[model samples]
Target: MTMTMTMTIAGACPGFRARLLLGGALLAGSALAGPAVAQDMPAPQKDAAPGLTKVASFEHQVTGVTVSKDGRIFVNFPRWTEDTAVSVAELKDGTLTPFPDAEWNGWRNAKKDQVDARNHWVCVQSVVADPKGNLWVLDPAAPAMAAVVKDGPKLVEIDLKTNKPARTIAFDETVAPQVSYLNDVRFSPDGKTAYLTDSGASGALVVVDLDSGKARRLLDGDPTTMPDKSVTVSYDGKPLRRPDGRGVEFAADGLALSPDGKTLYWQAIKGKTLYSLPTDALTGWLTSAVVPSALTDKSLSGKVETVGENGPADGLIISRHDGRMYVTAPEENAVKVRDLTAKGGTPTVLVQDPRLRWPDTFAEAPDGTILFTTSHIQDSAFYKPDAPAALPTELWSIKPGAAEATGSTTAPK
Candidate 1:
């Protein structure tokens, strides 16, 4: 078998594929994904331990951050607090400057207006610049996580050089706007389409056809995409609850497309379980009768939760080199890795830091440096409006070799 296939299988089923099935039987119907006994998974090799050194931090509250192909960093400042302003900025020479110098407002297409002091986009939650150097702006424009607005939920495409939006795709009530807090996005390997996570009340996976400007929402409110009730996430050892006492939580936040672009893995912000589905099943452009069954492959039905499996995980990364996936767990103040080659290896803790507050997003540098954000969002005023604010939110980076060498990387299942 080719290395890719061999690794995919190995990564998914370490040495105890059959044992994992037996384990699954114990939790039948619910779902169980594993290679063998969680304890039996071999301990990963430890040689060169890489550590997360504090690189750069933001003066104001940080929302989302994305690293460019050339290593330029872009971040979003949402209007979460009452008086604070909303804007997108770039990190240059260690200074945060207004990107394209525009304040947060409503969005418009490239043909509409240029970004200047007067006219700008608003309420951007996440920012991702694609491989082709196009910046994608995800706006979920309500005060905090409340999905009260309709016209403002949009995905704006901005040209890097001009800082002008080339296109603006708006979400309306028909598309369940209130339920669509558009979160993160990942481009297909070919860059022909982009998959966005609707982390709003009604969890969904939104797929956009870049060329046609057509968009579709699938797996809408599906249980797999939603966080289970029994799962309670404790940030920094503190239970995370909603400000309204209504159980504040997330359905999906961290998202990524596999290197081969065949599957999309995602997990809820407040959820402990991780789920994935075939990308082709989600594209929704094809009309084959067997498409439904293809979308529900039994192999893909297993639930991959790292609640107790891995540390409190966030920010997942899939290394193309070995088809292994990595996750950041701020609760444990660590980063973990699982080899898909073993199919179900136990997770290993690669990096841990008591100071790494709520490590959020992941970005890959050209030379394999893994970039991630540490927002300490749980400690923010948004979560505890009455508490004092923690300044100096940081963005961090570490190499895979460094992560594995240290106990930060998790073992395969």
Candidate 2:
């Protein structure tokens, strides 16, 4: 298979397929997004790595980030430790604006009983700019990883041209149970289906048909999706845990699709091993006429291929520029690249800096710069009650191939 279609990580492995599942990626964008305004960047975290540049800093916990094909930059703030003012925003030329408008972001935790969580951005986890020129948002609607509000969980698609929601697919208790937190999503190249990861109490992959608006939750509680009990997440050279003695337990979080869309890979944030499966295996069962059964689910599970290890990662993306998979190595304060030329191999550090505290999510610009966020999970109130409710987080970028750091700019308004 060609590099465009397959990201073969190693030589021959136990389950490496002869005809690997791979697909095309999004169209390349034009230039590197402009830097955040100078005042927005605190001097302490500036130029923390060789080619790393600080783009923007936010008051709330910032998790997911995406660079649109036409060069628009968007980010998301999940209502994890505090009630976020704006759940999703656009970063343009130095200003960060509530995308679409403020009305969509007006939902508040204080007014949860009064407000309708169905239409508003409630605990948005990811913002993805699809190849079809639409921006999609995934909202688990479970604030602080707690109870899910009735009619809260949803996936929304907005047309970039009109800046209005084109369609929305709602997930009920069956698809997004109270314990599931839909984390991230990758759209198929054809724009017909979407794949997502549930990184909550029990882990699973949620597949949605864009046209039918039908969703199927697969691999629920499977070993590959759940957090590995043997793994321990540590930060600052110590095991990160709350006073009650809980280590990182997020499951099936980081997700990546092959450049060609034939392959899909994901791993748990509280676990290390990466796993992948052919898009065909997932979509094939989803579209079939027979009702979903345990036998069918087990058959699909057997098709999953172990893609080797990436120690405690949070986000993942296959770079359209170099065709290598980039992983957010949160525990290591680094970003890594898994060379796809090999069959099934290990990833090497691409960028590492102390400032990259929990490099959470990734989005590659057309110019090939990799932009990620430092969510600072270890410092959040969930782990440390003494921490400020409104946490300060920053957006960072890794210039392809270690170029001179782009000079800083003004902060977003």
Backbone clashes for every candidate come to 37, 18
In terms of TM-score, the best-performing candidate is: 2
* lDDT computed for candidate 2: 0.79
RMSD of 1: 15.1
User: Per-residue error at 275 for model 2, in Å?
Assistant: 0.3
Write candidate 1's Cα lDDT for 1-413 as tens digits: 10100111121112211111112222322211122212121122233134544445455556677766555567776655532333576654323446655344333323254233223544567888787877787776654666435456677787876867788777665443665677778888787888887677777777778877667666666666666677777764567765875554677777877898987888776676667777876674433333223123343244333322443455776865556677877666667777655544456766766656788777665455666777777777767767554344666666567555554533222
Candidate 2 Cα outliers beyond 4 Å, as residue runs: 1-47, 293-296, 403-413
Expressed as tens digits, the lDDT of each residue in 166-285 for candidate 2 is: 888999987899998999999998899899999999899988899999988888888899999999999988999997898889999999999789999999998989999999888986
lDDT of 1 at 334: 67
lDDT values for all models: 0.59, 0.79
